[model samples]
Target: MTDAARDLISKAMVDAGDPVEFAAYAPSNIALSKYWGKRDRSRNLPLNSSLSISLAEWGSHTEVAPSESGIDQVSLNGEVLDMGTAFASKALKFADLFRAGRAQPLKITTRNTIPTAAGLASSASGFAALTRALCGSFSLSLSEAEMSLIARLGSGSATRSIWHGFVRWDKGRAEDGSDSFATPLDVTWPDFRIAIIPVDVGPKSHSSRDGMNHTVDTSPLFAAWPDQAEADCDFIEAMVREQNFTALGQRAEANALAMHATMQAARPAITYLTQDSWAILERLWAARKNGLEAYATMDAGANVKLIFEAQSQDDVTTLFPEAQVIVPFAG
Candidate 1:
């Protein structure tokens, strides 16, 4: 860990009598403005601010407790994971931030409600929940903002996953990333909906982290992205607050396309959107021309997610029968 990271962790350290079971749940989120590049990889600081809407009831549940077997253990969705597995290794490494060379053995269990590594924000939810569980297990009294700062060490998008509904992560101007954290927006639109059109539900061809680094290093077009993305984030946040669905939908779709365009400009080009993904966008565009009110965004994977109001639910479902609709603010 970097000195900045270690210092932050040290400050948040608390003493608990004994490790007891602590569990937390965090909702998966879809970025509206998109977090495409990083300013600081060690701390997972973003190059530009981004906004997202949480997926209600579709996320991860994580539990942390002292290991009964006297050794570290990890499980995902009830399946015991080998210590060398990627997820297990990453989870344990994250735990090390709190362990700080201590010999405390922890049992970390995470169960994701959404498809893992399939374009949905599973890592975001996973890390957010783990951060919460770890804090609870250690009896730490940190605020959500503090937790968000810590969770960014796990995943950049995880900073936003600390809350439900609309959230924005500010790409703070601190060298140590101490000011970088996410906060929930004060607006709530109960009719807001998101629909997932899964193109490939398996693990992505490339991780978002690797893809981001490669694009930043090789994509000449990325020079223009940071500034444009910052402007888009501000605009999208305003639209969300004003409940302007039309403006929000348009800018969100444009921003997603712009992000992908930068990736296409990379040396050797990294294309996550498959032919089928384009087909969905083509169909969506055609429907939009005929007055269907919805916009699409994609991440580092092939699946497409559409943002629309409750009024367009029937039309969206009629157009894409396979789409899985989720009401973000539903009780």
Candidate 2:
């Protein structure tokens, strides 16, 4: 860990001994203004601010407790994971931030309600819920914002997963990332909806982290991304605040395409969208021209997610029968 990260943990941890069982749940989120690249990888600080809407009831549930076996353990979806497994190893390493060289073993169990590693922001909810559970288990007195800061150490998108509804993560100016954290946006449109059109639900061929680093290092077009993304985020936020669905959807779709354009400009070119994905977008465009009100965004995977209001639910479903519609703010 970096000195900045260690110091943050040391300052926030009120107690790190005699841990008790603690559990937490965090909602998965889809970025409206995507967080593609990181400025500080160690701290998971972003190059530009981003906005997202949480997927209600679709997330992760994590539990942390003292290991009775006197060794660290991790499980996902009730299946015990070998310590050498990627998820298990990362979880234990994150726990080490609290242990701080101490020999306190922990048992971490996480169950994700959404598809893992398929571009649905599963890591975001996983880390956010783990952060909450670890803080509770270790007896940390940090507030939600403080928790968000700590969670960023695990995943940049995790910073926004700390809350439900609309959230924005500010890419702060601090070198140590002290000011970088996410806060819930005050606006709430109950009619807002998201529909997932899954293309490949399996683990992505390339992780978003690796894809981001590669794009940043090799994509010449990335030079223009930070500024353009910041502008897009600002505009999207304004449209969101005004509840202007048309403006918000247009900018969001444009921002997503712009992000993918950068990835395509990489040295070898990383294309996450498959031919089927483009077909969906083509169909969506045709429907939009015909007066269907919805917009689409994609991440580091082939799946496409659409944003629309409740009024367009029937039309969206009829157009994309396989789409899984989710009411983001439903009770």
lDDT of 2 by residue, 62-102 (tens): 99999999999999999999988999999999999988887
- RMSD, one per candidate, in order: 1.5, 1.6
**TM-scores for every candidate against the unseen true structure:** 0.97, 0.97
Residues 149-219, model 1: lDDT tens digits:
89999999999999999999999988888888999999889999999998887667789999999999999
Clashing pairs in 1: none
lDDT of 2: 0.90
Name the runs in model 1 displaced over 4 angstroms: 1-5, 115-121
How far residue 81's Cα lies from its native spot in candidate 1, in Å, is: 0.4
lDDT of 2 at 151: 89
**Clash count, candidate 1:** 0
lDDT of 1 at 290: 100
